[model samples]
Target: MTNITFKNNPITLLGEQVTVGSVAPDFSVLANDLSVRTLADYEGKKKLISVVPSIDTGVCDQQTRKFNEEASKIENAVVLTISNDLPFAQSRWCAASGLDNVVTLSDHKDLSFGMNYGVVIEEMRLLARSVFVLNENNEVVYVEYVNEGTDHPNYDKAIEALKSI
Candidate 1:
């Protein structure tokens, strides 16, 4: 288990964290259409998993929008904004915010995405703020586990890493 803190308070995650150079765990997340989507669905594309606590929060919403804007400039890449929110809510937020480039995925059903990625908050029904960049071959190339739960992530670094792949 990985030890992380929420708002400076310590919390324990449920599973082993995915590391750079390791193969990302496969997950069946709920798409906006309520259809199940797996890792294979993004084959041959660089994947950016922007795992956040929820889009309802200000920081999370900003991150999704920022990534959505960056997604258009990044060629052959899929930016997935993942959270524990329901598919309907995710879709609504995206549509309202005009977030067309990024895909918001939900892990409300099985909760395997958070467990497998080691970002699930133990007590709360939310995910830790994290980012994982994967190559077209499905190998993890970059990872960031935000130490402070409330702060925004370093998008510049993540974008730099994605551009390298």
Candidate 2:
């Protein structure tokens, strides 16, 4: 488990921390079309996952937008922006923002992605801010569990880790 804070109040996170070199956990998240999407869908390509508490917030918006922009420059890699927000909201946000390069997935269905990745905030029922980089083989290459829910993860560091893959 990992610890995090929301507006400075400490909160407990549920699930195991994803360590680099370990096999990435497989979990289901809802795609914009309400289809179940899993880690296996991105097999054979590097994955950069951006976990956010809520897409409606300012910080989360910026984080997702940044990754969407960066996704175009990254070859053979996909950027996934995940949240506990409903699939409807996620779709609306992505359509409004024109974030085609990055994919937005929702864990609202069962919190599978959150529970499996150790980013779920038990009290808030939202995913904590974090970033994970996985290699083509589905091995975790980098992980940054942001200390604060409202704060952004180390984007540069996560991107740099992707370069090594």
Candidate 3:
């Protein structure tokens, strides 16, 4: 139940909030190809999971693109951008934006990633803007549930954490 807001209006989020040093939770989300992907899919690699409300929005676009650009510089890691958008829409957006680094995943089918990661916005059925970095052992090294849903995440901090892992 992290406190956050959308456009300055307070909103409720569902599910248990994760914390640093905890075992990272596993979730099922749809890849751009409509295939199911889970945390295990990226085992043995440091991961930076970037959660956004929707991929079509302006801030979301910037967030995803930022991580996508940083992905190549990150060694032994993967950049994942999770959103509530449909797989079709996610694919479309990725293709249109020509983004190849970050892997876009969708939680629209069952909100698996949204609820498991505690980023689900109860009022809007969309994920709040958040960033998580996990070590190779799947332990959370950094977690940021952005205080404001529409704002950019602390990219420098997240990247630093990822690099430290």
Candidate 4:
């Protein structure tokens, strides 16, 4: 588990911390159409998963947009913006923002991804800010659990790690 903060208030994150070199855990998350999605759905593609508490917040919005822009440049990579926000809200936000490059998924149904990735915020029932990169084999190449939920993740480092893997 990892200790993180929302604003400056400390909170506990549930589940095991994901370490580099481990196989990325598979999880069920919902797409905008309410269809279930998992790692298998992406098959052999490299992945960048951006876990955010909610899509409505400013930081989450910026993070999603930044990744979406980057997704355009990366070949054969899928950028997933995962959140606990409702599917309706996630779809609305993506449509409103014109985000087509990155897929926004909802973990509200079961918190499957949140729990499996050990990013669940115990008190808030939301996800702590985190970024993960998985190579084609689904091995974790990079993992970043932002100590502060409201702060931005190390985007450059994550991308560099992705390139290396």
TM-score of each: 0.95, 0.96, 0.97, 0.96
Q: By TM-score, rank the candidates, best first.
A: 3, 4, 2, 1
User: What are the per-residue Cα lDDT tens digits for candidate 2 across 1-165?
Assistant: 446789999999988778888999999999989999999999899889999998989999999888767765778999889999999999889888876656999999899999899988888999999999999999999999998788888878888898888
lDDT digits (tens) for residues 1-109 of candidate 1:
3457888898767666899999999998999999999999999999889998989899999998887688668899989999999999998897888656669999989
CA RMSD of all predictions: 1.4, 1.2, 1.0, 1.1
Q: What TM-score would candidate 2 get against the native?
A: 0.96
Pairs in steric clash, model 1: none
lDDT of each: 0.87, 0.88, 0.91, 0.90
Error of 3 at 118 (Å): 0.7
- Residue-pair clashes, model 2: 0
Candidate 3 residues 34-135, lDDT tens each? 999999999999999999999999999999898778766888999899999998999999889987656999999999988888888999999999999999
Residues forming the 10-long window of minimal summed lDDT in candidate 2? 65-74
Residue 115 in candidate 2, Cα distance off native in Å: 0.7
Number of clashes recorded per candidate: 0, 0, 0, 0
